[model samples]
Target: MVKGIIAYIVTDGNGQDAVKFYEDALDAQVLSLQTFGDMPENPEHPTPPEAKDRVLHAHLRVGENELMLSDTFPGSSLKLGDQVGIAVMISTPEKTKDVFGKLSIDGLVTMELQQTFWSPLYGQVQDKFGVTWQVSTLTQDE
Candidate 1:
């Protein structure tokens, strides 16, 4: 069984200017910034020299949470759509609902607050920047 929380899915984009934007806007500290060229074990990956500058793995510290950001490798297809959204699961329904409402100011609300079969409170929205988000409060039974 899964014993630990490794990471969460936030946004999977081209991530061209995302690193700088996140660092500035969120005041996030980059813990580890690595690139494709830095990984020596994957020699067969065939990463171009220029692409080495692209972010392979970046850990950003935001408040109490560590947000990760990375760029998709060449030839990898990870497109954004309505079905896919960055899920942010909070511990409490109050905070989760508040965040959902705050993020929905200039965003679109695909789903309103309601009790899910798995969680106590659940909602979905797309932020102003075209990033989708799913806010949920996990129940003890889940």
Candidate 2:
């Protein structure tokens, strides 16, 4: 049985930095940050020097949601854009505007935040980190 689903992001080497960005921009609360260097040394499993500074794992709390992140493991490629999009349902229009303003500062706005038939406020943007988001404030019917 599936209990929950969490959004996990993989970055080339900027996973830690992305966590900081989300903290500042979306007020995401950082739960934990572990680096490759933090892993215990094992004779069988060796850690590479270059990966020491990369993020091993990170957790964050954004409003009522949670996100997991890590740098693409050594040798693995991290692909950005055209993959997945996060959809956020905010409480109010003001919050939607504030979030949109912050995320779109250095990002590309796919859709301007405006009143829609389904939602009072709706917008789509791809953050500077290449993460896509759909921010919306629901209407009375919702």
Candidate 1: residue 126 lDDT (0-100): 76
What tens-digit string does per-residue lDDT give for candidate 1 at 1-142? Answer: 1111224333344454776787799897877777766666555766777567666667678777777666666655566553234657677888887888898999899789898554698777779988777677867654
After superposing candidate 2 on the true structure, give the runs of residues whose Cα lies further than 4 Å from its correct spot.
80-142
Q: What pairs collide in candidate 1?
A: none
When summed lDDT is taken over every stretch of 10 residues in candidate 2, the lowest stretch is: 1-10
Q: Model 1 — TM-score against the truth?
A: 0.47
List, residue by residue over 27-90, the lDDT tens digit for candidate 2.
Answer: 9999889898888777797898888889976879999988877786688765655434566777
Best by TM-score: 2
